[model samples]
Target: MKKNIKWLLLVSLSFVACNNDDETVAETPVTAGSANFSKYVALGDSFAAGYSDGALFKKGQDNAYPSVLALQFKQAGGGDFTTPYMEDNLGGFSSGGNQVPQFPRRSYFNGAAPATVSGTSATVLGSHVSGTASYNNMGVPGARSYHLLAPGYGNPSGLVTSPPTANPYFVRFASSNSTSILADALTQQPTFFSLWIGGNDVLGYATSGGDDSSPITPATGVPGVGFDGSYNALVAQLSTGGRKGVVANLPYINTLPFFTTVGYNPATLDATQAGQLNAGYAPYNAGLVNAKNAGFITEAERVRRTINFVAGKNAVVMVDEYLTNLAGAGLPSYRQTTVDDFIVLVSQGVSAKAHLTAGNGTAVPLQDRWVVSKDEVALLKTATDSYNITIEAAATANGLAFVNAKAIMDQLVNGGIRFGNYHMSATYVTGGAFSLDGIHPSARGYALIANKFLEAINAKYGSTLRPVDLGNYQIQYPASL
Candidate 1:
């Protein structure tokens, strides 16, 4: 009886093991939560359009941040994305035997220096650009925050003119001549949107060495006034559809390679050359004291205006408008650029190379437009801070994600960022961050930006989207192009 009971227990255990040996089930991938990517739209400036190598070309657009993001979005149920492609890889356009206004063809580094493809580029005809298809990327090359809200901004009638009331890039595929960029984007009824405006507002002024426009009152005048009003209105409108989006703030312009590459004290002078430069400025330095004593300038202005050059790394002399007009006193307002002063990248060669002058001969300083003074940098900082505040507040209020582009730029400029197999910095062309234009990002840089956007979206919306392998994105076409 005991043997029979033991045999029965062994049989029951063997039967349980056999039942557990069936095929296992595979788990399904995740899906979009509340966010819908059935229709995605991107609203921004040149960066959004993938303007690189100094022009908006087909290759650049194909690698645009939005385009890169759309591919990742596809994995998470995102749908089709389209852009108003330029006529050809050569970029620029011509109609009726005339070149497109304002858009010079793409430039490439031809070993020696930057050069463009000669003659007329292959143009995209009116038929291709026309139709009711909504443009997924409405990133007008030069559009500002206010321009997106301005009515009739895509009017074909104004594309060829000076203070262009309409944007030529928009005119290429605008649904109607009276359509604003925001209006056109709205017509698509996007389920998801990515907006990065307000860069051009202060950028236009900052890049011009503070000569073109004023940064003050930008995005933060009175509640209903100027940049502040326009920016708020644009954000409010974009949020109307309750579609999720991400907004990026501007970087401090002075920190960019455009303003930081040319150092304030780049003059590497020998002992004799240094002596000559100092001797030349002695009379001008003495004139500053005299001007101060005569009440022409204050004591602080005298010290600030003084120009002294030592044997080693000497400051490049510059024409400062702040110095009291000393021409009456038989002097010019010439002083070396201080640490507070920042020179534009375009002034790199022109500032160091001596040129013909009326009195000082080859030693005359570069003009004020070439160097943005300490005071001007202060103005830029104020405007950038104000604009960023508005951008951050709007993102929070609208329940959208905010990408701190300013921090990314700071990291790139200060300590270079490593993204996969590449190292990108804000050090102009070679850095791989900015293109030949020294403003927009290269393809790899845009890929990294798309990754940032993805990270933000995944975190905010509880999605599982993967980032692009930065190594996959090419930096530029062959320099020979």
Candidate 2:
């Protein structure tokens, strides 16, 4: 009986030891925060390129957030990062087709002489050119999230179309057929990544006056992609071994200078012009009034007119037309009078009307038509809400950290953030944050954005990345001004 008891006890001990081994084999140990991000990869659209003042020039590219962020990362013990850069010096539109001149570059302050065009070359720049651990920054301007997976993405000489075919930045670092933006990034097996996409997804529509809804197919809605599928795919690929990363959400373009610069003032109207406007000769003015009373204050106040040529129809309110008409009618004798003089006169209203001198005097009829209205504000808010919903949903499902860029933009417009000791607003020309096109940001503005990203990173990953110094960036002004 004692021998049998000993044998039973030995078998039980053996079974317990085997069970422990099985448990240990099934459960793999994970290293927390081991994904140190020695290799940094940035992916996004025009904002990623540091496009400012309606153009992508060398100056803006050099001061781009990715480059700035790379500098910060290197100082923080991260590996050196690389970017696919353009060779073009003159940073605006370039001529491609026959006889059609490229869009002229204008000063963000005053429309001055057109900027020179720069040429682009087909070449890559970085430490490693043909391997998994290759280029770091692949932030292609004007690229959609879906475009990352397309096969012929890096063709520089392809037929240029909407969202243009040849992105010189992408063409520079493009590898063999086996390598792609998404595939290459994945192969590198990055420990850390930064993605700021979905801006261009709605940007094209907004810039085209909502006239071009071409991007909205059956597959995607207004905000498009809902991006759930792509988000899931990316998470599956990148988070396979629990890799971590940060993602940025879209901001409301309406909050930018592009939409806010053109406003109108009904009280500044002259008696004769007011009569015409009241009679509906200026239908846009009427819309602005309706929009204002309805609570629209900015770009959302502009009515959308199907006809491009007709005035006062469905279109955004433009203060220029009324000012032009007033100047032509009120001061016929003055030669070579400019819009600046008119703006000055209109801004002062009736208080400075007596200071008018025929030729040199700045006084003229006050016409307020360039400002935004209340209805337009509502429209912008609606668009912003829709976009944020899509962005938040994607981030949540994918376990990616998202920055509320729209809220940041609103803060900038509402005078909540101070950059370089200057309060930033959406006002054109005078606003320190935005460039001349009233759409894109200045170098200082991009710095503010970089700080926002850093804040989000800290929140999501418990990182202590330092904020960018806005003072280091330069703010260029037109020499003519």
lDDT against the true structure, per candidate, is 0.76, 0.53
In terms of TM-score, how similar is model 1 to the real structure? Answer: 0.85
TM-score, structure 2 vs. true:
0.64
Candidate 1, residues 279-307, lDDT tens digits: the string is 87788788888888899889988887787
lDDT by residue (385-444, candidate 2, tens digit) is 665575577567666667888778878778657744767666655666777656677787
Candidate 1 deviant stretches above 4 angstroms: 1-30, 93-102, 123-128, 160-162, 213-217, 221-225, 310-312, 323-331, 347-362
Best by TM-score: 1
Per-candidate clashes come to: 2, 30
Best by lDDT: 1
Poorest 10 consecutive residues of model 1 by lDDT? Answer: 353-362
